[model samples]
Every structure is written in C-alpha cells, then in structure tokens.
Target: MRATSQDTAGGVRRTRNAAQTREALLQVASRRFARDGYASTTVREIADEAGVNVALISRYFASKEGLFEACLAAAVTDLRRDAGDTSLEAIAPSIARRMVGATSDGGRLPDTLLLLLRSSGDEHVDNVRREFLQSLSERMAAASPAGPETLLRAQILLATTLGMALLRTSMSIQPLAAATEQDLLGPVSDLVDALLAEKR
Candidate 1:
C-alpha cells in the first residue's frame, strides 16, 4: 500500500515526541548531575524530574556510566574549539575568568566534571583527567613547543580553571564570588602570560 497523509503525520509526531523526550531527559539529568553530583543523582530522580519512567533514561542513555560519558563527550566537544584557537597565555586567563563567570550562578558543565572527579574517589581520576587535559594540551600547544613546562602550564591552567570553578560554584567563597570581572582577569592573565613565557 501507499503511504497516507495520516501515516506521515503520525511518523512526524512520533519523531518529535522522541526528540522532546530525549531533550527533557538530558536537561533534567544534566542539571541534577551538576547540582547533586553524578554519583548521588539517581536515574529515578532524573526520571521523576523529567516526568518519565526510569526505563526511559536507560533506553535513551543505556546506563549512568553511559550518561556521564555522554556529558564528558559534550564538555570535550564544546571546549575543543575554544582551546584550539588561542595561546596558552591568553587561554589560561580566559579560562579562569570564564570558569569563574560560568559558576557565578552554578554552571552545569563544570559541576559535572567536578562531580566526576569527586566520585572517582580512590580509583584514580587519572584516566578521565588525562583525557580531558590531553585534549586541552594538544589544542593549546598548536603554535608552541610541547615539553614538560608546556604541559605543566596547560595542566596548571586547567587546574586553575577547575579550581576557580569549584571555589565559585561549589564553595561559594566571598572574595571570589564578589570579585569583579576585571579583578579576576587581571591576575589570571598575568599568570598565564608568565606561564606561557616559561613554556617558550
């Protein structure tokens, strides 16, 4: 038989419904994983927040580990271009300021990474950390030399960004929280310039 108009409309509706469901689940999962941390945030909670069944999450993402991996992938993809475009010196301070700013109201991406770091516990955050850092290093080392100092600068920059993110987002420290945009950029940029010099 031939395809009918109703059949085509029904297919379109199903596709839209699935997309909406996935998007809703991802939004809930991302926020909860960011706010509550990944290990503490359960599929049931995410499901409830999304107003869907627990099985729906599994159907969309397979497992909690899979979901975390997806978030990591997203974080990596989003930052890859930013990391690739600028010098380490510029990138470092930019990262510090952006991270601080991103966390002013509690950022989901940074929080998710922090949560993953914490949840790793005694198992070693090395592999995951390395994956994130390696991509960063490669991106920043584009026009520069690659060596211990360069790696160190990259690592420190990453650490600074993450540390600032934690301080602003997680701990909610006053001086940092109250810091002016320039207050953050001034010191961070100087440090990055120095670090980049060392890498040279």
Candidate 2:
C-alpha cells in the first residue's frame, strides 16, 4: 500500500521532535557537566532536568561518556563557528568582546569555556581537553609569523584568554569582573600586537 500524506506529515513531526529532544539533552548535559563535572553528574539528573526519558540518554548518546564527549564536541564546534577567519590582528579584540559579552549574560562562563576549564577527574576526558587547547594554540600560531617561538606565543595568548575568562566569569575578581569591553580592548589588543608582531 502507498503511504498517505497524513502519514508522511506524522513522520516529519516525529523526526523534528527527535532532533529537538537530542538538542535538549545536549544543552542540559553540557550545563550539568560544566557545573558538576562528568563523574559527578548522573544520566537520570540530566533526563529529569530535560524532561525526557532516562533511557533516551542511551538512545541518543550510547552512555554517559558518550554524552560528555558529545557535549565537548558541540562546544568546540560553537567556538570554531564564532572564531571563523578572524585575522591575527583582530583575534584579541574579538575574544575580548566575547569575554565581556559573556559577563552580561548572567555573569557566567560560556558553556564551551567552562567545559575546558572544569576537570572531569577522568584521564581520558582531561586528555581531550588538553588536545583541544593544543590544537587551538597551533591554529593561532599559524596566523602569525613563523618562528621557533610563535607557537609558544600563541599558547601564551590562549592562556591569557582562558585566564581572563576564568577571572571575569568564574572567579568574579574585583575590577576585572566589573570591566567593560572598552576597558579591555586596548590592553588586549596591545598584548596581541606585542606577542604576534613580526620582528623588525
């Protein structure tokens, strides 16, 4: 028998619902993992928070480890999307703007940065975090003049970025936490120029 239009519509709706459910799981899982760390968060808690079936975690992500990995992957993708083709000269200001913008949004670290900063206490998970930072360092270095120290400079830049995010959002340090984008742009841009500038 041929499928009817109503059946086809129902199938489309089911697919949409499934996609939404998967996204919901990811968002909730990301927050839980960021706030509580992977080992400390439970699949049941994520499901209850997301209003989904507990079994759906397995259906979507296979296991808690799978869910954690998925969350990391999503966060990395988001950061990449935001960083698209930003020139070396523009990187520091771009990052500074994003860091300050994050402060406006409830004064919390972005889920992406939080995932990297938080320790899961699992060797495998921690290794993944290191690999991400290393990869990002390499990318930043590639945008600068090649030299023995270029990669090291990029790593420093990454460290500064991460440290600022932590202090401003997580630690809420006095003046830094209260700083505006304009307050940060000049200092951050100067640092980028000093670190990535070509030798005279």
Candidate 3:
C-alpha cells in the first residue's frame, strides 16, 4: 500500500496531541502536588484537571509515580538545562534569590521543593528525589571546572541552596526570611564566591 497525505497528517496530529496531553498533565500535576503534597494528589484529579482520561496519563507515563517524576522534571526545566552563560560564581546571587523565591507568594512553597520534601514519605518517591538530586548535582558540577574542590563546591552549593530554602521557606526564620532582596543577594554572592576562592 502507498502512503497517503491524510495518513501522514493524522500521524503528525497524533504526535502533537500526545505532546499537548503530556504537557497538560504535567502542568496540572505540578500545581496539585505543590498545593496538596505528593501523597495527597490523586491521579484522577490530575486527569480531570488536564481534561484527559486517567488512562492517557498512564499511557504517557507508566504510573502515578512516573507522572510525578515528569512533573518534577518539568518544574525545574530552567535549572535542569542551564542557568546562564556565566561562571558558576556569577550565578550565586541569582541562586540566592531563587532560594528566597521558593515561597514566591509568601504562602505556598515552590513545586520543586515541595516535591522533594514530600518524596520522603514513600519509598518510590524517595528514589525519585534521590535520583533527581543526583542528576541535578552532576549537571551543576559539569558546568564548573573538574576537580575535587569544584566537585566539593557543587555538593556544598546544593546543600546550601536546599538549606536556604528550608530555612527561609519551611522554617521561615526571622531576619533572613524577612530580609530584602538587596540584603540577601549581596551576602549570598559573597558566600558563593568565598567557596570559589583558591584553597588556602
């Protein structure tokens, strides 16, 4: 049988539909997970929000856990890919700002951080969080020069970022939590560069 234009068009449409459905599911899942926590958000709710059948979600992602993983991946697409065309040193203040920006609304924490915190309740989510952070660590480390110290810096920076998020978002500590962007950025930049300094 010969290929038909309608068949080709239908194939392209199906691919596009699949992408749209996946994106919709991801968007809804991120919001629901962030607002309600991982264990609380149901697949049916996600499907309802995405205006797709629950089966399609499983078709797109093997399980609810898999869909959650995709949500996590999509949440930090910016950070996952690249920060900016600058030295890791140059991005410290921005990272610091991001830490504060976690609770961008002064109420709800970010979806990414929420996913991480909520991941601990279940074994599967634990693996997701662990793998996600491991890959994240590798990506950040790759951006900097290769060495023991740089690798150390990468790990330390990851801890620092998460610690700041916890302190500022989870714990809501005083002064640091209430500080102005100007106040936090300067200190964060200095702290970041201090690690970049030649080992004494």
RMSD of each: 6.5, 6.2, 7.9
Candidate 2 accuracy as lDDT: 0.76
Encode model 2's per-residue lDDT on 1-200: one tens digit a residue: 22212224234422226677788898888878876667788999999998767878997899988888888777776676666665787787777777766422232345567778766566786787888889888888888884789989989998898888667655779898888889988889888888887767
CA displacement after TM-score superposition, residue 24 of candidate 1 (Å)? 2.8
Per lDDT, the best of the predicted structures is 2
**For residues 1-200, could you state the per-residue lDDT of candidate 1 as single tens digits?**
21212223234322226666776776677666656776788888887887656776787788876665555555555555445357655664656555544432234445644544544232333366567677665556553454556766766766776777677667788897667667777777776666655443
Q: Which residue runs of candidate 2 sit more than 4 Å off their true CA positions? A: 1-16, 102-109, 119-128
Q: Candidate 3: give the clashing pairs.
A: none
Q: For residues 7-104, could you state the per-residue lDDT of candidate 3 as single tens digits? A: 24234422236666777887788767765777788999998887666877787898888887776656555445434434666567667555545432
Q: In angstroms, how far off is 4's CA in candidate 1?
A: 19
lDDT against the true structure, per candidate, is 0.60, 0.76, 0.64
Candidate that would win on TM-score: 2
Clashes of 3: 0
